[model samples]
Target: MAGVYDFTAQSLAGEDVPLTRFEGQVLLIVNTASACGFTPQYKGLEQLHRDFAARGFAVLGFPCNQFGGQEPGDARQIAEFCETKYDVTFPMFAKVDVNGSQMHPLFNYLKNEKSGLLGSSIKWNFTKFLVDRSGRVVGRYAPTATPDGMRKDIEALL
Candidate 1:
């Protein structure tokens, strides 16, 4: 596959969304887990989305259960938790495997483009991949890297 735009992912609402729809926007693609310690990063991620959306920046969240089954919730439950707890307004996708044989194609492409400390395999929940406006994976951030801390990089892209 080429870049992120080459993939299609299911939305949290069960709609098929072509990544090409976001082709011209700078993206922060994250593997999220509802019950992980990094779950609170949703607030920061939402803040990022709100702060830069007008400038063509977006945060795309993908719920993943590959890590210790931290995100065990179904689509409805995950959507509810995100809306009620973090008031997240960014686009969120359905649950997917971030590693192993069942890994989503988008993530596979991302990891191949920008490997982290774990070398292409996602380390844990909240691992982030920054994509430029052209859909090229530009940066890979570890799970511990806070969304807020990535402002400068995101800003540069915008």
Candidate 2:
């Protein structure tokens, strides 16, 4: 894909949503895991979404199980966990493989656009890719990166 808008991912509800729907919004796309230690970051992410959504910003969560099977839940379980535990109201997509040959096309484009400290491949669950309103990958945050710590960067784009 040429950019974020050129791809589409299945949502938690199983609908294919074209990235073009978020064309003019700054996006923070994360490969999430419900059972991971960083799972609690969902709260911070939801807070960020509520805080900046009016300014055209969004946090897109995509569950993954690549790391030690941290996210073992199916779509229903994942959605329930997020909504009940973290009160996550941000957009969430279906689970996907972020590494290896099975990696989703959207993630492939994201990794190629902005590589993390180690390399182009995503390091683990919760790894975040920040995209600008124009669909350019502006930042790649590691799994350890907290949502609050990224506020400054998000503000810069806004």
Candidate 3:
């Protein structure tokens, strides 16, 4: 019965963020990368955040470099790239490994809650997990899924 609120992650600023703080809000959790082809998606995600934020919705980005080392940057570098390039304003966490033995606990819980086409392991960067207002995993989206396309799903949950 464990939900996403049971986990905590370090923010890009190095502060501990308990997922519980976001309870009762529909969440779009994504693993992001700065140097990947999908890096541009950050703009769309930020747009989603701004559009639905007043309605209890947020996009949480977790930087991951496990795929082709696409996010090979320190916390500061990643933060700068997101802000300068895509103008990302959503809450972003520190770099993490999303598909390995040392994967962060939040991701471990997420992949288990909603496995992808292949399996529980994350296939690539930009993989997204949708959590409902009750803090339960509701849907999983592949790395290729775009933020704009998920508005309906998010609206339904809200």
lDDT of each residue in 46-94, candidate 1, tens digit only: 9999999999999999999988999999999999999999999999999
**Each prediction's whole-model lDDT (CA):** 0.94, 0.93, 0.93
5 Cα displacement, candidate 2 (Å): 0.4
Q: What TM-score does candidate 3 get on C-alpha atoms? A: 0.98
Estimate the lDDT of model 3. 0.93
User: In angstroms, what RMSD does candidate 1 have relative to the true structure?
Assistant: 0.7
Q: Candidate 3 at residue 34, lDDT? A: 92
Q: Residue 9 in candidate 1 has what lDDT? A: 99
Residue 107 in model 3: shift from native, Å? 0.8
How much is 55 displaced in model 3, in angstroms?
0.4
Q: List candidate 1 segments past 4 Å from native.
A: none
lDDT of 2 by residue, 1-158 (tens): 39899999999999999989999999999999998989989999999999999999999999999999999999999999999999999999999999899999999989888888888988889999999999999999998999999999999999
Q: Which RMSD does model 2 reach against the true structure?
A: 0.8
